[model samples]
Target: MEPLNYLASFIQSAETGSFSAAARRLGLTPAAVSKNVARLEASLGLRLFQRSTRSLTLTSGGERFLHQVGGAFSTVQEAIAGVAKDDGQPAGVLKVGMALAFGREHLLPLLDDFLLRYPGVLPDWHFDNHPVDLVGGGFDAAIGGGIVLSPGVIARELLRTDLLVVASPEYMKGRAMPDHPTELARFDGIVRRSASTGRAKVWTLRHDDGDEGQALLRPRVIFDDPEAMAYAAMRGIGVALLPMPHAARWLKSGALLRLLPRWRGEAGTVSIYYPSKKMLPAKTRAFVDHVVEHFRRPEVAAVFDSGRYR
Candidate 1:
């Protein structure tokens, strides 16, 4: 037997999270699945799984190895199929994960152009406020901000913005504007609840002059979605801590007013994320390139410009 084939078994088990599940998927017994993974680990001189009686989890080296090679084999298959057909046209179900607000306001609008360019590809998009597991969930790509990069991924920044205070003109009509984050507690605050923790987030702010402050807010409205909180601010519910992508149009339209403009919460980068780039399938490659190039154009790029408040 080519011990090399066990590498595929290793990757499949990593994706499924258990030897039993991988065995069911691969039409093998759980014992065979475990043995193959153990052989692959032995061949590599590494411990791949931290095995327990009821579970299997990747070790640190296993995580890094997966990051480097997870989708490579399937991509090689796609490449071979392309060569056989004498074409490199992207054709596959391109699964994408995106944050709800940014996807709707930015990515969704530009997708028609991408589809036109890659007609062979089918887009499968999942938009939400929760975190995404790219490897386990089998997404081809994901787009959004504030994501902590997981074990097997890389992020290429498309845009960055500052989180600032925003409120509808109506909400601020008779109220004094906050000069610092310290004064934010006196006003009605609209804030976010952490999807992972279910607790309201604390605001740590920075001043242009380099002063800093933190606020533990008792929010009048707590939202799990960024766009919803921005909308709530626009409805005069309360002042919101919002990233510029969510606050930009309202600021330009005068529906919302920015307070303490010199002060901002942590700066953020919006990025397109994927697993290793070594041998990406044409569909994944095309969508990634298309989105990057789309944002590089002047008119489209201006909307995501950090200079707006700088």
Candidate 2:
């Protein structure tokens, strides 16, 4: 078998975590998949994986090999697809990474439209609450809220979302509302620990009058998961700063109320980012345009406005 085919089989096996699963995907028998892996391992003289009756795990050597060879294989696939394109229709697998909340709230609805518009494309989606290195992971595109972009990646703003300080209506009932950023010190705060850097995100707020003053409030309760933090806020645990989309439904139902609305905190831009490449495939280009158009709708804008968490 060709080196590329062997590499592909190895990658499939590693990703699926079993020879049978990989064989099913590759249209080969389980024994054939096992033979390919064994041959490849012998040729390289390295133990790629550790296997047992119940589980399979990548060895240190296998991990490194996958990272290097998987990236190369993706590049080859992209090149082949680029040459194979005709009549403005692109054909290839487009891997996308997105934040969990955004993917469910906004992206899920638009996916069908994108696929219908581009029938030649196959999509693989990976969702996480934290940022990921798109190019390193062979992702064609990423949709996320934060503005942080890794080197060699390009970002286009899809929409602007304002951060908000919110608390359960029960929590806000009789207590005096904080009129300024400084007053936030008196309220209990919930913090989202950064999954990328493993640091708690400090809540930053600013006055609306174009004043330069800002407040960085520390959290009384710090959690790694944003959904959990939002749940705690719903239960009236403390005031929390959250993305507008995540906090919107609760705010609309009166379960949570925005605090200090007049004080417009820092505005964050939701953007689609991709690796800066010489030629973007037609499918990727089409999907990017589709997302931009979707977010531009007035009704979509209203959702974020209603859920404004500042």
Candidate 3:
């Protein structure tokens, strides 16, 4: 096999953490996969992986090689697709990283539609609340909210999400609703630990009267998961600050009610981020355009109407 093929086999083995799995994926035998990796490691004069009877793990050198070589592989794939007459059809594995809550509520439902439109494409999605290193993890793209800090990554804004102060009607049945940000301190706040920042999200409210205040809420119950936080808020546990869409269904059902509506904070933009390369694969570009166009629909925008609060 060629050097590039050996490198590709090595990457596949590292990603799947098993020679057998890589072999199945690449249509090679387990022995062939092991031999290719071993030869590649010898050519580079380094141990790329630490293997045992039960598992395999990448060495530091292996990790670095995967990151650098993955980009090179992506470039080669793009070049081949560009020159090929069948460039109109995108076919390849496209890995994506995104927030768990957002992906579940938004992206998951649209996945079937995407696959139907691009039947030749295969998608591998990794959903987590924490920030992901796309290039290191070999992700083709990531959907994220808030500020993106990675260098050499390009970001395109998709939509804006507004923060809402909401509580279950049962929680507010006897207690008075907070009319301003200052009053929020008296309420039992349900806080969600942010996966990206690794801290509890601080609630910031700006009133229509030109008054702005921020509060570092200590939750009566702290949930690392957004879905759990939404559930707790629905059960009348306490006031929760969340994106509008997460609380929308409950709000419409009268299970949760918005508080201090005029004091809601500024909108945060959701965006798709990827490597800042001159040429992106047609599959990735198509996915980005699909997501952007979906969000631009009037019905979708109404679900998380950032302008409603402002």
Candidate 4:
């Protein structure tokens, strides 16, 4: 039996936490994956996994071995792929995770272009509002904001926009325009809450003179989605401090008015994140390059600039 086959099976099973899942990922039967792992254990004279009917756990020895070589085979596969691709094109599944709104609003439209460019590669994407564990979830890359950087993860900033206070003309009607951030209390405030944490967010405004201020008003309406908050602001619900990307069209079309424009709210970034693999797979590498290039394009670059909000 080929040792590499068992090694691949072992790594896949360990990653998925189930032999059946590993089998699905590797295109083998569950029995075959179990048999391969058993053969590996016998060859190494060490039990790697603590298996049970309900769950699977890695023994201490298994953990140590995974730490050493969990990524090694992927690197080897990349080298072989590189050699093969010298005469052909890279082709495979590229799994990605992205935020729900941003993915639908910004990324989905660009898929046709990407597929046209890399016909051999397949795009498999998961869209969600919460952060995803890239490696543990078996994703090749993810695009989202406010993701906590994990050990094997790396992030490249795609765009960062300044947050601004905005409201519809109707919402601002008959309300006095406040000169300072403190005077914002005279109007109704619509604030956004974190979807993951369920905690309401407060705006920290920065002045040009190097002083900062936090919004003192309590939110009359709370939203977990940015689009909803933006729409509410457009419908004269209240003032919202939102990223410029969400309000760009409204602000540009005079649908929304930028209030206290000089006092910008908090800045946030959207980033592309991937595992810090020694030899990134061709599919992963291609998607990352394409996305980075996509953001770097002249048309896309201008809208994401924080300066536009001011």
Candidate 5:
């Protein structure tokens, strides 16, 4: 067997944690897998795995090696699969990372249309609130705001993230409606704190008439998620500053009312992140094009634009 075959055996053994399991995945006998792994270790002069009667675990060297090669190997497999198909059609798992509420509300709705265009692409998506390491996590792409672009990563801007002050009508029954942003401190506030910085988010509200004010909200409840803040506001807990995309549905259904219609909190843009544009995978390219086109639609763009809501 060649060195590539030995590396494959070693990788499979590390992932599956047993020679028998690796053999099953590779369609080889346990002895063959073990022998290939041994050959790999001998060639590198490194002890890769610590084996026992009932356990198989990677050493420090093995962990570092796997970390370096795992994503590269997966890309190679994807390329091979893409080539093996007819006419170089995109075929394979398209791994993506995105925020949960954002993905469901905006992106997932386009899945049917995307699949119709590229039937061979299977979306393997991860939804979390935090940023994901694109290369180390083996993700084809990620979508959200405030993601730091690493050396080899590229981002395509989708739209500006606009936040609005909102609350349930029930919460405002007897309270005085504030005419200025400064009076927002009088209301109970449901605010979001940054998970990374451990500081509460403060937005400077701007109006079309060139007036500006800082929303000094008194925090009655604090959450780490914008969606949670929206939910709390809907239950009449307090006023929440929320992204228009997450608050649109509830606001339309009259479950929540927009406050301070003249002012908006301008956060940074939301974008899609992928590896360098050079030699990008066909599936990822197709997905990125679809997303960019979708957001360009007037109706979809209006939903996220604070100016329209105001």
Candidate 6:
């Protein structure tokens, strides 16, 4: 292998902290990766790692070397990718992270057309309701709301993810519809507990006139998933706070009814997150453009908009 290959092995092993894991990323055997690092050390006459039976830790020299060269190495890789992608064909595995329900209901429908357009690209998607480390986890892209923005990552907005309070017609059959956010206190509540914080979410509803009120929902049922909350609301469990994307379908089909149509909660947004635009891989670029274009359509945009639900 070339010296660059040895350096790449060292960097991957250092970042992941295990040769086996680095091997998976590099498409090499663990033994081969370890050997490449060893060769690189011999050539430089530097002990780069403190090796033991179960762990590998970088030495002072290794830390300094990595700090000096890591960014340049990444740039070199990106340049190579750019050159390959310049042919205007998007190919290879496109790894992405997304919430389960949103991926299935909204984005999955677009996959057939995307694949038909770019047959060379294969998608490897991970569905989780929580935020993921896009660069650290090696995801080409991720889709969701409230994903924290970090250096070297960018997002393209897809929809306004406004939170809506909704309940089934059956649940509200005998009860008078709430004319104000305060009246929501009278109904049962299907609340969402934050998975990361383990506390029930407190919703604050806002109106266009700059008035805001705390939605005082009595917690009769609780879930960690927004989709589950929507389903519970449809089954007459209780009035639930849900992001417009999750509740849109039900609201349109009359499975759920919106309450206090003038009020809504600001749930940041739903965006497609990806790496910096500079030298972006063809597949990643294509996928991002495709999704953004799809959402820009008037019919699709109206469906996910909170104002349309009113």
Q: How close is every model to the real structure, measured as TM-score?
A: 0.79, 0.67, 0.72, 0.84, 0.75, 0.84
As for model 5, its CA RMSD to the true structure in angstroms is: 6.5
lDDT of 2 at 184: 76
Report the number of clashing residue pairs per model: 0, 4, 0, 0, 0, 0
Q: Give the alpha carbon lDDT tens digit for every residue of 1-310 in model 4.
A: 2788899899878877889877865778989999999999999999999999999889999999989887777787667778777346657888899977788878888899888978888888998878887766667899988777866578998888778888999977888877777778877888888766788877788877877887755578988878888899999888888887787878888889988878887657889999766647777887898898898898898876556655
- Tens-digit lDDT track for model 6 on 1-310? 2888998899888877889867766778889999999999999999999999999999999999989988888888777776776366899999999999999999999999999999889999999999887765778899997787876679998887889999999999989998778788899999999877899989899987889999999889889999999988998989999988889999999999999998999877889999777537889999999999999999998887788778
At residue 200, candidate 4 shows an lDDT of 87
Q: What is the per-residue lDDT of model 2 for residues 1-310, given as tens digits with 9 covering 90 to 100? A: 3776677679878876778766765667878888888889999999998989887779999999988887677688667766778766866688888988779877999988888888888988998977765654557799886636765568988777667778898888889987777777788888777766788776566556665434455578988766677889999889887777677877788888888776555547779997555436678887888888888888888888833444
lDDT tens digits by residue: candidate 1, 1-310: 3554587678778877878766754567878988998888888999988999888899999999988876677776556657854256778688899988788888898888888987888899999766576665667888976666765577888977778888888989888877778888888889888766898888798887899998545589888877888889888998888887888888888888888878887646888988766546678888888899888899877875534753
lDDT of 5 at 140: 84
lDDT score for candidate 5 against the true structure? 0.85
What lDDT score belongs to each candidate, Candidate 1 first? 0.79, 0.76, 0.79, 0.82, 0.85, 0.88
All candidates in order of TM-score, best leading: 4, 6, 1, 5, 3, 2
State the weakest 10-residue window (summed lDDT) of model 5.
Answer: 77-86
Writing each residue's lDDT as its tens digit, candidate 3 over 1-310 gives: 2887798689778766889877765678889989999999999998999999998999999999988887788687567678772547876788899988889888898898999999878998998877776655667789987535565568888777777888887888889766667778888889877666777778677777788888545479878876677899888788888777677777777777888777676547788887656446777888888898898899988888745532
Prediction 3 TM-score vs. true: 0.72
Residue 243 local lDDT, model 3:
77
Candidate 6 Cα misplacement greater than 4 A, ranges: 10-24, 28-35, 45-88, 148-151, 276-279
Which of candidates 1 and 6 is the stronger one according to lDDT?
A: 6
Better of 3 and 4 by lDDT: 4
